[model samples]
Target: MASSLHIDLHKISKFVNLSIPALFVVFLSAGHFVSFYFHFFTVAFLFMVIANFFYMTVQKEHVILKNFGLMGQARYIIESIGPEMRQYLFASDTEERPFNREERSEVYRKAKNIDSASSFGSQQNFDPSEIKIRHTMFPTPKEALQPFKITYGEERGLEFAYTITRPIMISAMSYGALGTNAVRSLARGAKLANIPMNTGEGGYPEYHLMEDCDLIFQIGTAKFGVRTDDGLLDDTKLAEIASKPQIRMIEIKFSQGAKPGKGGLLPKEKITDEIAKLRGIKKGADVVSPPYHPECDTVEKTVAFIKRVQNVSGLPTGFKICLGKVSEFEVLVEEMKRQDVYPDFITVDGAEGGTGAAPKAFLDGVGLPLLVGLASIQDCLKRHGIRNKMKLNASGKLISPRAQLVAFALGADAIYSARGFMLSLGCIQALQCGNNTCPIGITTHDPELQKGLVIESRAPRIANYVHNIEHDLEELLRATGCKSFSELTEENLYIPSDTVLGNYRLNSPEVQAAAS
Candidate 1:
């Protein structure tokens, strides 16, 4: 009886499918005979339907299209817009990954210089797995908090040692990774905020130098702005870049948090004439940087390279890395000690860091998160008795003052925020940074899209966002009974017993010693 019913249903389905097109033809014929306007409308509608039907049936690419015909097209249309629908209509404020509505809204509020205080209780889940800040009975006065400042290369006695007054500075967002307008606005904003900006490895940093802001020239594996024809570091070009008054420091990037082992990928579609000229690459092809520097293949070579860059640039020089294997870092540190050639600073980019484009495996599965990496590195440096030799800068999803405070407690000397500043310039978290279709023009190079990001309007917002974060940082510092970030210790942070951080803390010798 079931088999017979299935057969009957199949026949009925076929009949309905055939009858719908026949009915459409009859309607079109009637419309043609009835009225000219009706005929035109029916003809246009039928043409679209017929074209879609034929295309879906003939298309062999999608299995669903071949099987379900026009229904598959409808499904695809709905699926294509699923992200937008979920983001705007269905997803809760705390549901989204990377950045949720609540987080983005906080940044937006701060960027607009509006009050970002919450009315109701916290939306955060206070589960046993959550980390919390431990408050003391006696809170420190706001006036007692010291001004935040970190001097790079001061110990090394470099001629152009740079002092950063703010703990939060804009992280590396390259020109080719971002649009021209976006870069200029960020530079202007950095100037207004009195914070330094890292000129990402996109070469030359023309736009970054246009504004009167302190800049850190980054040299990627590709050596974009300061590379020879064979893609090796060019000392002459490096010195020239360092000579710029705005160029306060130079960072040799080993790897970023987003793609620790993988190189940066700039799509061919986004590459323009200016980007090509600056990067010293061809304009018509995708630019894939090397995974590691050609000259610094071994631990010994890496140390020598740092010293070489520092000597040639005549400025504070550092290296950035996303911590992977602890033993590998131990070897590097050991080598640095042997050679007595330490970088001025070490930027530890966490796995949660943002990037324009990276493979899913690297982005999601690779490298250590900020707190873990920062704490591990701190422990290692302290154990090796080199903690005070160099500054430890942290980067990854550190947008809020609370987050920055946690980083401070974990041993981060300074913080770098890329997406935070991007949000200040009105990024909608569209997740189109990889493509040349950023709706807000922050990431895309498309002229039409770039127009949406106005430098004059957006620059001040960046300044506002920085100022607000600084203000909140002071407030949070006062609440913690700490005079400054320098005073924040791991004891101030309470990690859940069942969490990964808790496990690490339990295993940490430092934590164990403190408990003993």
Candidate 2:
């Protein structure tokens, strides 16, 4: 009996490591000293009662705690362990979700190049009567090709013609906010995997030039990082950056999922003299991005702006947006058709997207979730008969093969992942990224934390994850009899929840035109 208690106690310590007196008891109890053990047990009993009483009585975010209480500090410690506690105590195999332990374990094993295949039981268990199911019919036979390549965006025109080899592309994170090494590593990783990396709204960092990988230059409303004297598109800057062979695409950041309609903010401390000079903003002041672009107002102006950059840059030009109103999109499409201008691609980010910092209301409340936005965007484009005009990219929690496949099957030419890369660099999802105290250096500017992230070692792991997911997708493609990823059509996917099993096929609005 004592041996069993010791084993269980050790397991608790291994998982939680509470960093408190209660945990000290658990550690000593396993030491095989029975007489002194009663004293340790008494201490443990007292600690548990005091800790629970302190934790359960008050909500952490209460104003009282903020003004004059220690409650918030205690809550912070407890919240930090939320992941470990959920995993060890309450989460059964069936209950774990949102990139569950099972999926995370699989990623780790596959990264090590081990064969991590599911055995026997299903990865998911549905309530027999409550859930719905749907599937495709007349499935095509699988074909042969590259290991990690797959189709990512919409399949209609300039986009339908190309395929993304790896599902794991870098997310839209600004460079000024991240250290020089962070940007360099991301670029190097993308170069190694034949994938692309987005140079966030902060503009093209000089360090990003070193790796010479595929680049997606982002232009935001603030126009802080790159703009001319007229405070508009800088032709010289765009031409120089876009002329680089590594720069494959450009994305205008109209809005993002995290804080739709809200603008960018650079704290006084972060607004370094260098960034201020480059951005044309005064130093030592709070930098607030304009809510909308002063240079462009309507869809016509928006398209013209896109054309301005595309004409000088001579590369694929796209825009990233989190959808809001359907009518707004309809208007935009109508204007695009009328003006005879087309975007090379569009990225739809889900409302659940995360950023280093954003207003709470916008983070929780604004923009449509990605699945809904993708459906809306897809349906609108098809209805406008402009589906053939552009490719589609999806972002927001699309790190694994299944998630990426769902985005593609629904309607996305490619997908981007942010938190996933952070994960590769040893982020435990502690949510402390916005502060300059990140322990693993995935999201902070602190030199000490930055030391922990070995860009050299971690970049390859990032590449490994990209390759691993693509290989997994290849298995699915093989099951669908598709040799080339570009050949995958919506007819290959079905939601089991809908009860539409292998009975139907999807048709693009211009299916006839493509067929002809």
Candidate 3:
């Protein structure tokens, strides 16, 4: 009898799990005679006990509920908040994905105009497969590094041949994707920094033009701002939008890195009346853009559409793409050559570059990464003898000066950073971008949340971010013994021999010829 009464440690969980439901049942049985003051509490407790008892004994769907009863619910609650727990407490500085604590801290420091120097050596693993920049014995003086400038539409000679002095520009992020304050803040920052900002294909540039900054109006697959009733590009609307003095260039987005084949998605919960009106969409349904433009079903048609937009808008026009098939891109270049027509610029979006929400499969397994895609696109254009015809802009996870320099060495003429600018705007990386409940107000439309993002304070941060990047870029260029970005070449970069990228670089015709 004594042995039977002893508690077995191994069965403690099972005992507790059964005891909890039994206690609730007993408490509820005694609640019938409770006084009037305890009536409300008794009813609430009775409901909870009954529901849990039903789940434990009757519900066959969840085995945990059947075995552990109310205790099983705690497991679900903990699991639901697991991501937040890992992000804030469990994960180390470099263990997080998308952007780690160390990377985000660097951006925040630069944005705040504070010294971002690190005391210790890099926390990075310094794996043999990693890429490194080759510094020269003879470093160039800072004065020797000339100011960088890239002129769009220089080859075509458009009426507005936009020249950007700085290589870093704000990437496309639609007003609908962001709040009014966020957009205006970015515009003011762009004005302060004397840089261009892309109006992410959000139908209208109303908020983007608030501060009189240079604007690159993006025409997405849906043709939001310049679409006809039939969902095709409207020349009249396109001309009207292009007529705005702030509009300097036009980018036709073929695809972004987040979801290569999948189109843009805006949750219905985020669709406000203003957003619905601006996008010409209904309020109740999720907004899913067409995977491809209806008018651009083939490569030839795509080129023709580009020409049409350029002709109508009379602006420097280009296209943004997340490179998927090399063969398809080779065909596209061929078509451009055959037609004797080329875009003013080409924005190569890497698979790793997505500031918007997207499906897990598409985000994880889709287009080529920036380094590989940019190199391939540059190689293809060079092979076709049209490398000089269009400016090449690269966008991915390039938030720092070193990363930007690597892109230049690989063939990027300019750099666009969406997440970098986002961080500068005080994003906490809550990973709640898809939901409408962004605590920081950068991505949320909620007025209460937006109150946190004061435009006056945030705008300078953006300008500071750009200035700091420019300063560091010049410093890096001087260290590389390069007078200007034009002097950077693939030889200025070194990759470990065992990496796939290294093997490709070593065997490439260009490197082989140079080696010989």
Candidate 4:
């Protein structure tokens, strides 16, 4: 009887188990569509019936497991259901601890324009730190004020100085990994918020222009996005893109949080003709960027090239990177000290971020956490006495007020978020981004797969999320008694006292880098 039951269940699944009611629930709840719902159900039932019929006849489980193994089968069967499992087990409500659950909820509430005030009183479990918290004077704040503009270079001149219109902006995640609608929606949202969006190493995208969004185009190691006839950065090519009103900043990518000092990869399967053309590589072949740039090999040359980009573009240009050896940063700062050429800004990205696809070793081992890296860069500037010469921005997992505030307190002029924005656009963190099979349609080229993303609708949500976060950030700044984000100092914030006494202290820079 048990054997018969298993056989029947298998048959049912193979044939018309989609008749199982859940499939039609969305349709039924969608409208007063009693007839249409029934029609869909009937059609679905027939489809499942045929499917089950084949399944019963074939009965190939043993064959599948033998040929594909558990891992392979999991990809299709168990993994296909991974999203459902995560939603049911986890929540939009449960806090992510350490950096856990309730914390994420507060941010989501503020971003969604819902009440962020906790009901069961404050969620904090602060154990009374040894360090006393500090408050500020002139608590009332206004929008659109001074020093809110991020200044990068004084010696190099004002043209190189840049502004971060809002503390919250979109960080880099290339277009190839994120679909057309996703890019469009994000750009539209950034335009509405008057913040900048960093186009990942994928280069300048046309969809970014369509939305009239301000942008920071990233230059990867291979110089993939903007290239000369020899596939290097072309002045004309840079100018053509820079001439547009929306294009705002440029960054030369040396390394990232997920995999610093590693080469880039676009699997052979993803090397579409269009992507190949945009990146100036060939299609159907695995695309890899050299481990380093051919031109900017030395620290001095890197700074020189940065100036070349800024000189030609007439817009802010800088570098987005993870802090590694102090010696290398010291060398680069030494070059800046000698040459008087400064990048418009420096974005300190943390190791907490993700990549399209990177080796497990690099992902786990390379780069520094955002806090350490940002603070290191800040200290470098401060110690070098050139702190005032460049704007410092923070990237990597910055979304909520606390995260933004932390960055601001740590001396970052602004913070940028990529995955968090992806979440606001309805990503459930399925972790399928690099595979070209994102169920959310944020990362794929297949037309059939792109149906899930609706640009016009999702675009507004993105805009709404950005607007809410920016306004709330202003509120937090006001509550802390600062007039502008630039004026916000470390005295306005607090951290766990133990964290200072612990491992963080060991990693702290021995000599502060001078900031002029």
Candidate 5:
């Protein structure tokens, strides 16, 4: 009997850490003419102790929870908020993960029309092996330079072909992926900046066309906006969409940077009633776009599809893709040349590009970075002697003037950014985009959160960001002594390595000879 009692006491002592606190609370409540607060506190602590016992014995998922009991909850609590704590407390300005503090700060400052000049000294380590653009001692005379603009589909000879007023346009960000206010603000802001806004693969909603912004309507693999009930392309619906005057170009999205070879995902939580209606999907269901285009299954079919859309729409047509099987693009270019067909433009999305949501495998390891991918695509097209037929738009982390300049030197005819504009609209880089609870209302559907983003106010910031970036771009072009982007060349830019870099340009005699 004595031994059994000692054993029972030992087990009880093991939980004394929790029991002591509960006993103290209960003692206080019983000793005093208990206030309502004390009663509630005592009850809560007792409930927790009982719950902790059940969790310790029954919970099998985590060993710590079973072994350490309630105290182990600290691990999960700390883990849940770890990202937030690190971002605010520990991350350095130049620590580039998604977007570094410095990058986001610059966008925010420029958007707000605040002084964005850097002070003191540079934060970056001047690595000798880094690629740098050559700025001539004598810059081009600003008085003789023309305003920023670029035209697509000049070779295609279409009446409604796009003549973009600015090289920096809003990249494709779908209505379903973003909040209603975000889409509307982007539309209004693009109108103010006189720049084009892409309607991402989700589909075109009325908000996209609400402000007379030039829109590049994108047809994704699922063909959401223009699909028939059977999930096939409906030419009648496509024609009707194309009839809109504000719709200047049509893009067939083959893949995006963040999730190349992966489909677009709108978690069930994000599929609001309006989104379901716009995308023509059932509400409260996960919206997953197909990984591949249903219509463009082969290279020949893809070219034919582009021509079909162009013919039906009477607008410049193109495709957007990230770097994949290199030989695939080679085959695509070859087929286009052989068939005497060409897209109006090709948008090369870098792997570092932003997405609303994607798997870790696709996001981190799937595609080529923007620099390599853009150069490769450019080289492939140029080698085939068909580069002149189409424009090349580069999309990735082109928030900075230097990044844009590097892209232009690598053969980008234009640049676009989605996340940069989101920053302009007051994104704090909370990294909660995948969840439907974006605190800033940019990517959330919560009415209260959406109210925080006032379109009338943020629209000006968007316009300002666009203006400032273009101004900075012009400054860089002037420094390089280039009259326009057309005057920029690979020779003007230098890679810092002594070893000869693998030239992406394939039209050179040596490359042609090697290929033959």
Candidate 6:
């Protein structure tokens, strides 16, 4: 009985599949009798359908096309627009994934210089496992907030040094990784905010210097901006970059949060003549920076290189890294102690960091998230008795006041944010950055897309966004009985005891071994 029913169903399915083509044929024949235009369109459409049908049936590669015929193609169309559908139409504001609607909306509002306050009640679940800020019974007096600052590498036995006036600075987003207009807007914004902007692995571009903003020149493994013909650090190039009065500090790229071990990867399509000239590399191909610095393979060499760059540039220099093995950091600090040298600061990137492009495995599984990485790095630095010698910068989704405050509580002296600033520049989080077609021009080099971003206009939005964050941070500080950021500590932030710290098993003995 089941077999007969199955046969009947199969026959019906075949008839339905065959009926579609039969109907098209009927339409084609009817159209021929009706009008020339009708007939022509029918003929063209029929040919396309027939070709698709033939390909579907004859091609054995895709089982869906072979088994389900023409209807199977619908799946591909739907899959292509799945992310868009989910992002714009279906997903709720609170649903957390890659920067939920709420997060994006907050940035958007702030960037637009609109009110970010929500009325009625809180959207967050006040669950025990959730993180909570410690509010004192006696709050500090609320007053007009002032722009905050943190000085590093100043009077620290360096010929030239830096005093970062803003607690938040722009994180590394390279010239090749971002469009010229985007870089210009960010530079302008940084100037407006009186903050510094870090140029990523890609060489520094002139647009970054156009606004007279302080710049932190980053030396990636590829050493693009300051590299010699042989791809080694060129003293002349270093001096040239240092000579730029706007260039304030230097950062040695070890690893970012997005792809800890996988170095910078700029798609071939993004490589333009300007980018090539700036980076001193040939254009028209993807640029994959090496995973590790050639000049500093070991901790000792890394420390020596930092000192060398500091000496040469006569500026504050530091290294950026995503937390990997705790022992590696410990070893690095040990080397720093032995050499009596250290980078002016260390940027600890959380695994949640954004990237222009990265492999899925590296993006999701490679390094520790911001809080854990920040804690571990802080612990390691303190353990080696060198935490006070250098400032610690934290990145990776440290966009919100709560996140930033938490970071300070965890021992971050300053914060760096990429996606947050991108949002300010009108990034809708399309996640198409890896490709050359970022819809809003935040990551694209295409002239047409870039035209949508006007530097003079978007720069203000970036400043507004930064101002909003700082303002909110001041409020939080006042409520927490802290007169200033310097008074913040881990005791000011609280996480539930039962909270599970992802797959790291952070509470486990092995993971917490380095924790103080």
Candidate 3 lDDT by residue in tens digits, 4-84 = 689764376577656655665555556656545555555666566677778778899998888767667778999999999
lDDT of 2 by residue, 341-371 (tens): 8778889998878788888899889988776
Q: How close is candidate 5 to the true structure, as a TM-score?
A: 0.90
> Mind giving the per-residue lDDT tens digits that candidate 4 earns over 1-516?
466436553444333344434554555454345555566665664554455445445557655433333223445787778756766685444444223456555545554667766566655555664333356566664653443555444436655345555667788877887888889888987887778888888865766777888788888876775775455677787888777777777878878888888887667876777787777776667766777776788888888888788888877778888888767898899898798888768888888877667888987788888877877788778889988777787887776776777788788887888877887777655567777788788877667777878887677676777777777777777777777877776667665546642245445655222221
C-alpha lDDT of residue 161 in model 6: 65
User: Which candidate number maximizes TM-score?
Assistant: 1
Please report how far candidate 3 places residue 27 from its true position, in Å: 6.8
TM-score: which is higher, 5 or 6?
6
TM-score of every model?
0.93, 0.74, 0.91, 0.77, 0.90, 0.91
Give lDDT per model, in order: 0.88, 0.68, 0.88, 0.71, 0.83, 0.82
**Better candidate number, 4 or 6, judged by TM-score:** 6
Name the lDDT value of residue 167 in candidate 1. Answer: 85
Residue-by-residue lDDT tens digits, candidate 6, 1-516: 466435554465466578767767777777877755666667766775775678566688988667766666777899989888888788888895788888888889989989988999877766777777899997877663444677778538665667876678999998877888999999999999888998887785577888889899999888988887667788788988988899889898899889988866656765668778888877777766779888888778888988889888888888999988987888888888899998889999999999888889999999988887887787777777788788899999987888898888778889899889999999888878978799898798889999999998999998998889888888888888887787788678776666534333456444577685
lDDT of 5: 0.83
Quote the RMSD, in angstroms, for model 6.
3.6
Candidate 5 residue pairs in backbone clash:
none
**Residue 328 C-alpha lDDT in model 2:** 92
Model 5 misplaced stretches (Cα beyond 4 Å): 1-45, 264-273, 281-288, 498-516
Descending-TM-score candidate ranking: 1, 3, 6, 5, 4, 2
Give lDDT for model 3. 0.88
lDDT, candidate 2, residue 48? 57
Write one digit per residue (lDDT tens) for candidate 5, span 1-516.
466446553354456546746675775676466566566666667767776777678778888677766666777899988888888898788885788888889999989999888889877766675677899999999897776667787897778767977879899988867888999999899999999999997765578988888999999887878886656678988899999999889998899999999876557876667766777667766766779877878999988888898888888899999988778999989889888989999999999999888898889999888987888888788888999999999999899888898899889998989999999999998887878789999997778889999999989999999998988888889988998887787776876544123344434444678899
TM-score of 4: 0.77
